[model samples]
Target: MQTRTALSLVAIAALTACASQPMRAPFSQADLPAAVQVPAGHTVVMETAAAGDITYQCRAKKDMAGQFEWVFVGPDAGLKDRSGKVIGKYYGPPATWENNDGSKVTATQLAVAPNGAANIPLQLVKANPAMGMGAMQGVSYIQRVATVSGIAPASTCAKANEGANQLVRYTADYIFYKAM
Candidate 1:
């Protein structure tokens, strides 16, 4: 019908208008204060502390890279309850720096111990994202951790393997550094 065709055209137009665009820093170099310096790198090397299944830490450029780019490093832990064993293991945030550009990074890497790493692209970071509000006092905010399942295992299984094989929760911990 003519009505259907017209409606479809309108929808297409709207969608096209929303096409992705390049990111530009809201403020230029001059806009930033004199004291501000580009970050070096940030990473969270695995340390003590366990939540949900991941042990994570965050670091920034000053202590890492030479230039001002942010990087987050950590580990995610996965398990198979029934087997009392770990199905897979890794630690990295899909969105790192604890975040980016007033938010978090778009890429997440799920690294399996002894070698394997599962990379979640920046697009997904653009997809399932965090919401922010300034001066939101007394607000209860929450978020969900997206999973990168079934990573291929390495030839050598560590003590992490030994279980009855059961349903379990896997977790990735991100350690965010304040500087980056």
Candidate 2:
């Protein structure tokens, strides 16, 4: 019993320590790939570790035009920081970002690469026009990196489960960039 208590305390202390540190820039401007270009004079302002689910709704095949018999639509999820703070959210085809402080940025996919079978495709997202005065203020671009475990479960799309909302949990690094 005492050992268990000690272990729990240690874990809490570790989480608190991690949460206290300020977020850091993900990478230097020069390091950004051409597809992830930020405006001239812009640089990475903040980077947060996002841990959350990527919700998917199974849908039936539409005319059998694609290889997969069924399709999954959505990546909607609330995002959290390393210390487990609800900092933001992500959603939609024109993927959007909304932070706790009400900052919002709608993004367009500029590039993507497969991370893993159980992870959503990592992407470079360009902000339409970063708005608000919160953690996302002045943000012009975002990169979804180090993604894991958020892939849509295609197998769940059995005909009977069509239109069902399923959530696939995932984690990733979300780097925000802004004009200096």
For model 1, the run of ten residues with the poorest summed lDDT: 134-143
Q: What is the lDDT of residue 47 in candidate 1?
A: 18
- RMSD in Å for model 1: 19.1
Candidate 2 lDDT tens digits, 62-170: 6764323334455666777655687878776567778888888887778877766777776787778768878776677788877888866656466666667777778
What's model 1's lDDT at 82?
A: 26
Best by lDDT: 2
* Per-prediction TM-score: 0.18, 0.69
Report lDDT (Cα) of residue 14, candidate 2: 97
Q: What are the runs in model 1 whose C-alpha is more than 4 Å off? A: 1-130, 134-150, 153-170
- Model 2 C-alpha lDDT versus the unseen true structure: 0.72
Model 1, span 30-103: residue lDDT tens:
32222322233422221111223332222223554432321223334432222233322233554322211133
- The clash tally of candidate 2 reads 0
